[model samples]
Target: MASLPQALPEQRAVGPVTRPAPPPIARVRRRRRPSGEPPPLPRQLRASGKWWLGLSAAVLLACVAVVATDTIRYVDVADTRVLQAIAGIRSPGLTAVADAAGMLAAAAVLHVIWLTDLVLLAVFRRWRHLLVWLGVGLLVINVGAAMATTLQRPRPFEVQVLGDWSGFAMPSLPVTVLAALLVSTLYSLVPPGRMRTIGKWLVCGLLVVTAASRLYLAQDHPTGVLAGIVLGVATPLAAFRLLTPNAAHPVRYTRSRPAHLDVSGERGAAIVRALQDQLGLVATDVAPFGLAGSGGSTPLKITVKAAGPQDDGGSCVFGKLYAATHVRSDRWYKLGRTLLYGRLEDEKPFSTVRRLVQYEDYVLRVFCDGGLPVPQPLGIVEITPEREYLLVTEFIAGAQEAGEAEIDDAVIDQGLAVVRRMWEIGMAHRDIKPANLLVRNGTLYLIDSAFAEVRPSPWRQAVDLANMMLVLALRTDAERVYRRARRHFSDEEIAEAFAATRGLTIPSQLRRMLRQQGRGLQDEFLALLPFRLPPVRIQRWTWRRGGLTVVTLAAATLAGYVSVGLLRSPL
Candidate 1:
């Protein structure tokens, strides 16, 4: 009786009381703007080229004004005094040292240094930096010659010239070329940071030695040496800073793949901010992930903080970073493919980083909507407007590549079912290699949809099926995979799949894996089939391909000729 106390009137209810469920957390979806309409770049990210150029211009104008006005006499007098002082202290040893320093600025020495830089840059595939270096060198030489010709000032008066000299003495060409060469070499080869900082001071020290030696030998006036130093260092430093910024084209000595962008330091901080502001994700960490398997773009694993109570702590997401280098790589890749295998169904390169990211995001959404077992499509985050972008998606946790995971019958069926679903939806993942397919708790997940094509050709779809089967068969025997595949695909379809697949059709990764298997798995699968078809001809000739072939050969020949001429030209 005591345990069954009557309910108070205030707490009584006509029926079972039900509290309203908490409102679902509202997620804000960022509306993607057209690529052409990206927000204006922030002022801080704008290149500092204009400022450096202005400073150089001011120096040039000051020198010209001084020489053009009555101030020329004062500069000449000062130059004479400096040379006289240098001569007054000259000894046999100091004079010999000055002669050696003059030789350091010799054209042959500069040529050797320039050629070495070219070779190193070419070897490292730093084509952009190499081009910048060459262009800046030409500009500095031409500009220095023009300025010296315009001034046409004579060597120091009443000072005996002791070293070899050439050209007008107002702005010494040797000193200018030496300064430009040393500065450009440092920027082109040395990475930006403490090392570059130290390299800069070393370059300055060398420039001082050359300038002072020129003054010591009375080969050029002090004003001429100063002008040469200013012009030589400023033009290239500004141009390189403007054209080949460290943010886009980092200089590294590692032989690793060039497509991977450094995901640490300033870039990492930028990524965290972009994710939080643009994609509404509080990213705590961003690091390179699966870089060994990826070649086209940098892969990153980003860890984000939980948003609300429903979230199960923090979660990891996958990101693919695309930049201008990747864009160029895509162009080169497509061009090579066209030249080698003739227009294999839409081999056109993406026009920009934005378009490349947008295409992948669209394909991901389409696949997800079509009920594919792909990663959930997260929004794209802009890292540097049109120059760089990051495509985000859900990370399939605890997943191993299909080749590494133990493939049971269920895994085999799931792999086949992925292709079946793609066929039903008129989609083809042009890259169906082992690295792109992930297995998690027996579920197969397809990734790297950048190459996936919607409404693809039948040949392309067939190639996809073949690639997937080869991947699955690598884990199990071909017979088991074939038997499991038949439940999802017809025998004729499977035959067509193999028929459409050739060496060129298979991705490089899958091709290499098949070679390693070495058991003739492809031939075994062909034997199990009731009927056979000839291997599809992948090399289709086209006028465009022929024209590209001709142009490419011509360009290569011209480049070789130029390189040889540079190497053989007189010092």
Candidate 2:
């Protein structure tokens, strides 16, 4: 009762401050997303090595200025103290060894190393690696020597010189040359792994020891050594960035038989030169495959002397060349597909030639790793920025169509088994036609893997089964193909397969062959094999749907505002 005077303020019903509660509407705000196109790459990403180069270059210039002006003369004392400290630990044996190691990384030895590396690279035909090696050498040795000579800074005075040397002190020619040579050589030659990591640490240790040796021998100042190290690391990396963009090969093909190619044309000649210059390939001859499709990529067959590492100096391989016109077409088609229609063809979203080639190369390797039969992917080559790209692969010759080969039960069984294997591997060959299936030396090889996809859904896998069965139908009876397929497919799966082919794109060549063999292939497949239609997904909300929703909400909001204005109007 005493607490009545101290009762809850909220429960005081007759309080003057009483207020009504807000209406509990179940609406949530929809935040407007930014425009679909991605923002530009960051400055660091766009410039890459150039940013590091600029920073290192600025530091180098500042060090040179400091040494020239003697603005911080006491800082130079640290340089002298570093030398004295290193010399204090120096023994005759360690000095001799360091001196010898220094001599090994000398200009003469470096030049010899460069020449020898180039010759061996020429032997293995590691042209890109050779280019990087040469570029590093020139950037480190020649340009560094010139910079040192121009700076013309003097060596430390009143310091005990353990070894003899003559040079400016701004950038230690020894440090710059040795660091760049070691880093660049390792970068180009060593594959990324534990070995590469070990190589980096070893190089780093050597560089530090070498820098310490220069200090101990009273060869250069600390600032000079620091400048040399920065220059050495940055210059070679910048050169490497410029030299290699697309790897050793950059082409991919969609079809085995192309209707048009000009290997002797201007673009073809440029392609040959690019391969020769970048990859060190001696092209004995180049021939066009006359690939079909107006802008689709095709492979050019090339006979080369030392085209690959395992070459006996001469071998034949397939090369796909993509010039400026074709690259743009690919870009436009992919952009349109993604932004407008939002569909991918054969699971490969359209991209540049270099990237697409890389994807296929990776896919081919995966298939090979899993023991699937496919052409061995050789390498990729980029001639111009986005204009010219080329991809090389092992050329399998003397292969004919399934239609040309004997259409026995074994052939049918093998073909169906392959489709099953593809499905087992979660792969789908979107372009499974008789022409793409080759019979070579009594073995079936699946070719034109450009449209191949992995990890397909059951619906997509069913579509592939239908396509494979259709291709086999070209050589023999549709019923015969159905019997072989039924072993792998259930009734529901088979029904879904038939239903999936409603609007599948068929090549004109395969379409003609199917019509010639019999009537409508779809009808024949349905009549020959018993099947039922499977449920399909209706497309959910798209950009259009969301856009319409937003528009309706905005329109209602506007109408309410107008009504409020009319209510407020003077009459």
Candidate 3:
């Protein structure tokens, strides 16, 4: 039995207890950039003004204005004087040097360089960069031709035309083509750094020599050479800077995957600052993790500083860095799928990086609320509002991939149960490969839910179940896993699952694994089922599909025509 206790006496305050003022709320200053504004320029482009496009347009307008007005007389006089001065110094040796330079800057030599660049870009799979290069070259050629015809300025008449020439020479076509070729090749091939810096100076020197040679040979006016340089360098430089930014389409000779963004240098520092300011999570170190298994977004392991004193140094969180490149890749991927399978599911692409990250984060929260074994969503941190984002989540430490782990009865059940839960919740983990499944402490975890869908198609859900079962059977016997699955799903459901499962439905990683095994794993699983159902037809054509197909074919044909024209163009 317990006894009641007595009351205690009260004591007076020793002194007025002082309370320290709360620490000033730390305020983080964010860049006041508008959402529609482009991403911060890469380091190589930082020194240039943001209005380069406008500036180039202004220069072009000025050139046109000078040609249209009487001011052209003064410019022509200056041009003639400069050509005469160059002609005065012409000697046999000088003439020989000028001829050699003319040969070097000839249209044929420039076209060869252009062809080599195209081949290299294709071999390296730099498709975006390749497109920009082609577009710039075509634009320069067309614009230079039009401008030359409009101005109708003849070759310099102050001296003898020592070199072979043709057509009006307001903007020297050779000089323009040479400038465009050099600029495009440098930006498309050389990685941005000290090497590119040296390349820039060398390119400038070559351009100067070519322009001087043309002037010495009395082939082009000074103003014509100047206009050519301006148009050639400005147009492509602006286009490449805007379209294939170094941050997204960096030129590198290494074998690193393009999907994996470099997390060192400025991007790394930006990540740390963004996490601290936006998410209130102080990240210490950020490094890529499991790059070999990811192809969509760069996976990173972020070490976070602990908030409390009792914490053990720090803990790590997982992050997926999504950029403009990923957004483009997603669009191309969906377009390919739609063209191939005719809209199997909701194959719409996200409009922006923000939307992409938002959808994934929302899906993660939904799965977490529904009691699925997915990573807990830690809010998104925007590195660049619409251009780039980072989706952070709980890092499943000490977990081995399903393919590498010991898949026992419990592991198999948990894996099957995940699909059951997803089905019950009206959700489907569209990607259910061995790489996305993890086993730790006898519990299976599902990750990489970026492709998970809500209220997914019945076929899609069936495919999910089939994929999970196939993954489980990879380690254990098909009959044993089927027997365990029977407890959660019915025989008819299993049959439908296998029926929905096809070559395309399987994730790429799973398909590769199946091929490597050289065993009929999918067929074995199908045999264990009570009965087989007819394979679902995935291809269903529609007006949209037909239109898209036509457009794709037309675009391909245009691209081929442009390629051939580029190789054979008479600059």
* Model number with the top lDDT: 3
Candidate 3 local lDDT, 355-410, one digit each (tens): 99999999998887877777778788878667889999888888898888889998
Per-prediction TM-score to the true structure, in the order listed: 0.86, 0.46, 0.90
How does model 1 fare in lDDT? 0.80
lDDT (Cα) of model 3: 0.82
Please count the clashing residue pairs in each candidate, in the order shown.
0, 18, 0
Segments of candidate 2 deviating more than 4 angstroms: 1-261, 276-281, 293-295, 305-315, 331-348, 516-518, 535-541, 544-571
Which residue pairs show backbone clashes in model 1?
none
> Which one wins by TM-score: 2 or 3?
3
lDDT tens per residue, model 1, 1-571: 0112223433311221122222222234544546665342221424445665676788788767975784777878988998998899988899999999878788789788878999999988899888788778767777887777777777788888888887787678888888888888888899889999999899988888888888889999987887787788788888777677786678888877878888887788888877876887778899999987899999999888765667665678889999888988889988988898785653778999999999999999988787777887778888887788899888887889988998999778777878878887789999998899888777777889988998888889999889899999998898888877777777778899999988778888887888887878888889878788887788888888999999999998986776665545332
Off by over 4 Å in 3: 1-45, 49-58
The residue-by-residue lDDT of candidate 2 on 386-411, one tens digit each, is: 54567776666666777677677766
